[model samples]
Target: MTKQIFKPRGQNTTRAIAANVFSLCFPLFLVDAVRRVHPVALQQFHLLPPDGADLAPGLLEDDPRIVIASAWIDLTDGPVVLHLPHTHGRHFDLTLIDTAGEPFASLGTRTDNDDGVDVAVVGPRWSGEVPHTHLARRAPSDACWAVSRIHAHSPLDRPEAEAVSRNQHVSSLGRRAEHRTDHVTSLEPPAVSSLRQVIELGPAVFFHRLDSVLDRAPIGFERSVRPLIDQFRRDLDGPPPVSSWSPDLAEALELGFADGLAAIRAATAAISESRGIGWHAVAVPQHDESGASLAQAGRAYSSLGAPAREELLTLVCEHDGHGRPLRGDRSSRLRFPPDGLPPVRGFWRLHTRPTASGDKRHGIGDRNDLSPDDDGALSLIIHDLPPAPGDLGNWLSAPHGEMCLIMRLYAPRGEALSGAWRMPPIEIVDLDVDGSRPGGASSESLKPNRRTPS
Candidate 1:
């Protein structure tokens, strides 16, 4: 005779139900974000080169070193092929992202050579044979995104970057090829401004969009979680119980979304203090402490819900090391001690921007005319004053009001990726100190050569 195993329901069952609800909805959150911007299509590419005065393509935190080629992709009908042109030793990457904004595959200098590659991106259900000469990658979801970045060292490099971008192409199996478009347009809606607006989306509106995307894309979630997804569908489709009102189910839906947002915030907050001094470093574990490993939700939330770690490693500072808000009222020094520079094959940059409004201030880094001191230490002085005689190579413009400083390391070294190295502290310099300056006069009268940190 066969025996059946059963366990009694525990007090944590409701909480488990709530957590499962969050995982189901998390991936759809980003999918809805894309829909809020553009109408659904098989493929569309934005081919404009970044002018440093405008936003890049799909996301925020753009840099001047790389020009972006972005597109929203759909592979429900057949396989999609991304055609990468030969970059001739320039650094570039074509990152393939899933519905949840987690990178599933990469084609670039790090993975493939700069000679360029033609990659055939297939969906989970695709079984047809791909060409032998082309690289083959299976995407987890039918709906995905591709961001292609080409290195542009300076204003003079824009022409070459544009030529390389113009040659790249994208096509589906047995279809006419689609090229990049030149016009610039805004696809993102104005209503979705901040993170709070995303979290505050009501359940019915949010889930309705989520359910629609799941209908088209098969993300191939783990087998254990499939039942919970089915339950969510049933809860939405089936009628409310005889004793319950329709509004009650809506309340539960809102509660689940709130719970998911809270969980994400808590996970990010737990790791916020690991970076020392006044900087916030970005990091995430490949697996949890239990060794069970993390799936899409954990990876998606790791960089505070960014696409991937390979995209960029960032350090943010709202205040100086001395706990003063970063402003032009007082000068600040960002000193790189001996052997403290970022280890990367690509490059590093530092710039400033306001948290609430206005464009980012003028940036500076190794890409510019920066040079080390006699002891091989690199120092950058930030203020609104004109560049002094000796300060021509190290002066960075800081907006006169409150602002933030960001350090971005492109193609960071393994040490940075593994969290083995930390950035040095940014020292605050007081211009009014005695004996520190040549004449010890007020900050307004001080020349660049006369200013020194205490």
Candidate 2:
């Protein structure tokens, strides 16, 4: 008996279109994973920091006072242990994220009370006996991402912060623990620069990398989006495009890619809404299936945004509490009473940025410009000019055009992280009539609902 085989050209074209769309969104999760494991840049379980002279080139923005301890782990070999140092009186946080960049566990002053621990991370397929002293956390994929934030109050704080950073250790389950101090490796600038470029590859090449990533990733990770991943792997894993190809198939793939990009933009926009006080807080921890797929794409294209929730809760304020744009044209004051300061064990600092893209402008808390009253309450002035006589030591200079304020509470107390405590508002102050004495602006004017100082 002989069987005849037939091809449905229209059906094949339709499937190809659908596969292209899935391929576009797949990168959102894969890009970060690929970047972390790229042999040219990162090594498994190697600890690296964003030293003053060495910033992750592709990152969108970074703070000068914070040093990041980053490492990428592959549990395929065995469980990897993360050993944190005892940071006395210092605030340090280490966050562990799964392949999807969702933080599943954390360690720090806020989360661990400065007492360090040795935790073991294993892959989903691992079956082994972890030591009783080791806290075992299973990762969703074979690869895990960890970023630790060590607070450096100033240039002087670097040495001590560096010490804490060096104390971090990672050991494969059965091997002797390896401290980061045991080896010295400099940042790979050229490889880091290529991160952004690789993410922008053409569809065919991009999907090829995506397939390689999915192959190594946890199969359960794709279960939710199984159809999408399967179809893409089947239809789009073939050769490059050519003019000789079917016109309808070519057009369909192009349209699918365009539609995928549009879907990602819209998805990111919807969830990117600022949660009052000009902050874009992450309200959703584990994203819905569709959202998770698209948001990863949005963040990948935008540069190194937040890789994970690394114990750092940041709030960006483009407008004052009174609904005025944060601008250099007008002056503003952020006052923190000795009794009502940010509930943090680490510390809190407010810095200004010219626009979202500009470097951070030096400010009060950073430079010791904060001025404290008799009651020890610190009040900082935000303006374009030099410090005024009455200005507290905390003088945050506003940007020339529209500005934004990032109030970062490192090692934040539970109250701050749980939304139980609210950051004080930025009060827009009217500059003195002569514009000579910024000191003339009284702290009393900022006392809410009453003329007298609180």
CA lDDT, every model vs. true structure? 0.59, 0.56
Query: Ten residues in a row with the worst lDDT in model 2?
Result: 1-10
Instruction: Say what the RMSD of model 1 is.
Output: 6.4
For each candidate, what TM-score against the reference?
0.77, 0.75
Query: What's model 2's lDDT at 442?
Result: 53
Per residue, candidate 1 scores C-alpha lDDT tens digits across 1-454 of 1111111146433334444555544544544454345445535555533431122113454455466666677787789887788887777777777665556776587665468777888987789888897899888777677767787656577678767766666688656475654532323333443243455666545544555755644344433344456664564453233245365555555565666666665655565554434888655322121111124444444432232466567777877776767786467778777788887767778887742222233477776788675677777777665446556577776667777788877778899877787676666666656335222322333335444433
Q: Number of backbone collisions per candidate, in order?
A: 0, 10
Best by lDDT: 1
Supply the global lDDT for candidate 1. 0.59
Clashing pairs in 2: 28-296, 28-297, 364-395, 369-393, 369-394, 370-392, 370-393, 370-394, 371-392, 371-393
